[model samples]
Target: GVDQLETYFGAYLPQFFYAMLAPLTLFVYVCTINVTSAVILLICVPLIPVSIAAVQTWAKKLLSKYWDQYTALGDTFLENLQGLTTLKIYQADEYKNSQMNEESEKFRKITMKVLTMQLNSISIMDFVAYGGAALGLIVSVLQFRSGHIDMAGCLLIILLSADFFIPMRQLGSFFHIAMNGMAASDKIFHFLDMKESEKGNQEFPDNHNISFRNVQFAYEAQRPILKNINVECPMGSFTAIVGESGCGKSTFAGILTKKNENFGGSITIGGVRLSDISEKSLMENVTYISHQSYMFKGTIRDNLRMSDPDAADDKMWEVLRSVKLDGYIKEQGGLDMKLNEQASNLSGGQRQRLALARALMRDNSVYIFDEATSNIDVESEDDIMAEVHNLARTKTVILISHRLANVVKADNIYVFSDGYVAECGKHEALLEKNGIYASLWNTQCEMENI
Candidate 1:
């Protein structure tokens, strides 16, 4: 260790030593003239830590602000990417870009402020370290003339005093870097301190019969998305939820799946209120496929394996065939064909099919399709809807769709509007009522040229 240290010093110290020839010459002049260097040593010692401490204090403040800005930037980026389609449809790309630039500029300004503070602190520290030492040496030399110290002692003190400041001053500057690290730690600790979702009662009956009794829920405080949503999805029966936009269709599905647990009233699965049931057990019986189908970045087979890791390749092929994606996959190099992030490399219909295949692999007792056919092409939509219709025969399916025609064959349909169930019946029965469901259905059918 000693040899290594000396070797490192030998490599870099000479360059620093050469750069300080003027100061070294001054020291040589003072010492040779029988001057003392005690005052120089004293000034260098205290100023090292004090100046560093000041810089460190400022660094802590700056880095804390930086972490906040970084987190905000990440959140904005995610939101922008998720809403990219809407932005493009509305031609608001420039608007979002400007917003992003605004946050970026704020980040840049904070970064510059930190850099400026560091530079100013370092400049002041360097002056205190070098200038004060120089002045102290001048005073010590004058004192030596008054017989305070001998020539040899003066030479040693002059040489050693400058050398002493080198390490202490550098170490002092490191205090600022340490403070920045501490500031980052503050954010990490805050995240760590946040309360995790609660673990509830674990007992669940083998049979999965979902029932919602006066279930009330809201994402925001006291503003209910779902208001007294009383419904029952009996075992071995399909239940379709028909609703217009913002009618709490998705919210109801979310509650049934136990994705969002903060709700009023009771939701029971197999006689066990979901709030009392453990998250793991609830997930085991329920599988939800939403409107925006997400695909993991891997081969098609790899993504299929996510739902059932022990599933054989042939089983996956069978499931793919069931969703009518097998022919396409086979033509496009089979399951070995890689899916990019969110399946961006594939068409919208293809991604939807892949998501369906994954869900089918789970083969859970309950299936929730929240506008699952929204993105597919007409031909693909027909094929996928057919597959969904078939799945509903055996599994307790909750189909939430705006396309009324798809739910025509459903055993029961509950129409929702303004966060309430405005109408409830089979598709034909609801159509006969000529209410909101009838209007929406007529409008959608006209648009589809059906």
Candidate 2:
């Protein structure tokens, strides 16, 4: 899009403007030299633009289809590349490769069509531009032979006649660039017209308590992920949201973190609706940490300081120790330890722990961990969850996890199934009632024993 915009402004637009004005200016001088030759040039001038416009109408639609196919193929290729390892593990690499080849073929066909349109347009444009100039030149020579115009006038008419086609001819070559720029402009305008999330000026309370009442949400029409869900986590309480994958456990966490905001019903913190709270105020009061933590290639201290730039060395150590990574950090040369790109040097557990430490640096009133412990070792998971439980002593904590054992002591547990809350209570209470949570607990317990 940026490249198209650059070409549009830098080349096509300038030449198009010159084409619009230059011909009329040249037409006046040609008339003064020989009226008959000038009329010939004038008649041919409109044919060049008319032919270009006719070609443009066809090329425009072709370019749009070309871009769509090209982007879709790219997305499919990237997705397949990322999952190459898994595809091989499942012994489906050849099948997946075949799918990619099929998509590429579709893209190739669309590309051929686009090139055909461009070539066809160029052919028509070449005929009009050169043909128009040829007709004017022939007329000027005739007028010169008949003594209607002198030698100097004939030469001037011929010389200036070439300049007449220069701008329009150049525009012919840049027609594709103009088409791409127009398509890019359509997307840019649509993006600019999109409505941003509404924000409010009212300040949120320091004591953050979260509640979702009759909440319903869906990524698209006819496919709801969360339905009429109700849950509560008052200040100084630990709440657990447990469900099978794809049952909207993560979506619920996203709602609280404001990553997914367009939904039905109400989610509020302390008596204020989540939508009404300013993003700045919400960030200051709530922090959401997930399993896939992004770490830039920089010193450990650099990453931690991003959470709170004013954090002192002791404050960094405090958070690190809380996650039980202080001893490891000290052994590795403290806060100056350099993390490789994407923190590749650190183990998965270490990366997750480091992310947890960063989240701890923020003094938010509520913290939600979206499977932050899912990829870590058992020991690290225990230490991190223990520290998180301690942190919930003064702040609201929402834990969304598949591991039910860790949340057995939670103040309340909400079990989601098929997009709605099936049960809500303490672990012991749910087990006593033999509900969804009880069934999940039993299954996990059995797996652990094996």
Candidate 3:
């Protein structure tokens, strides 16, 4: 759309220039030059249009590089704003400013180069248009002296010549504007060309059993995050996954949510391959809540309603009560109280509980908590964990946590290490084995005593 406006102006320049110049120039010289002299002067008018059209075509091709730089400038500004808080905390404001200034200066320099090219083209076009007319007038006068034409006829020829080239000169300027607009259009077309992922053909099952068969995955291809991970989550039982930091704990949860898809082997939900299930259908059955719960700016009711848009006010309060958050909601002035950006108005624990309530409202068949209890206070954590355990009775629950205590009550526990499942069994069974799981358990136990 922006490009079209630029093209319109570029295409119209020639017409505008000639209309203004022809009448004025002809009016000035009509009473002065003889017929033969005027004919010679009129020859200069064609030069204006021809010169502008040719110059503009050449200049338009050169302006595209500048347009790309402008897009880059916008992209950088977006990145800087997103990371402004990090920059302030690290005292790196100066460093970021320097980078921003450098990009801006480069962008300014490129724009100036485009402008310089345009100015030079215009100067040359003007010279050809008016200079040729003047030279033509000199020759016509010499011809008039030789009795070749009458005075009024000379004036008419000159006036007509000026009329011809004025439009062409203005057109040359318009070409530059049109080309800049086209350069912007090219970027928009490129963005629009991105392909969406194709949906699979297999039908999804109503039941909610999830299993991974020799699954392997990595954010980076060479650095596998989960290697040969295999777990079977029964339709209505709690499965807990515990691991050290960077040991593919969250990656496992992400896989269950289909947020991380680069993997080897297969993951099936209710005997249907995860890849085969459409994203929307898969999302309908599963919900993953992480520690950092994103709360958009709105009332508490607004956030809850996002889970099930048509949920009634009573249903919202009921879900909040289930998550043990209804009392706090009432204390905070009920659901009408607004939350600021990212829910800054709520404390860390309140935000997590709200997230839990939001998840409960959805009533997804499968619920995965990835470090959901790691940040909140112990009291809040326990209340939420109790709620989770209760939910486990009717829905499949997958808990991935760094804290060993959080998953102790899980029906089955899997200990992960170096992208592989190092141990899997009941918590006591793993303790008896005295392997990786036992070692990790002991380490945490010793830390707690200290």
lDDT of each: 0.77, 0.87, 0.80
Over 4 Å off in model 2, which ranges? none
Q: How do the residues 104-135 of candidate 2 rate in per-residue lDDT, one tens digit apiece?
A: 99999988887888888888888888888888
Candidate 3 deviant stretches above 4 angstroms: 1-86, 121-180, 201-203
Output the better candidate (2/3) by TM-score: 2
Candidate 2 matches the true fold with a TM-score of: 0.95
| Most accurate candidate by lDDT | 2
- The per-residue C-alpha lDDT of model 2 at residue 285 equals 75
Candidate scoring better on TM-score of 1 and 3 = 1
Order of models, best lDDT first = 2, 3, 1
Q: Kindly provide the TM-score of model 3 when superposed on the true structure, using C-alpha atoms.
A: 0.78
Between candidates 2 and 3, the lDDT winner: 2
Q: What TM-score does structure 1 among the candidates reach?
A: 0.79
Q: List the residue pairs that clash in candidate 2.
A: none
All candidates in order of TM-score, best leading = 2, 1, 3
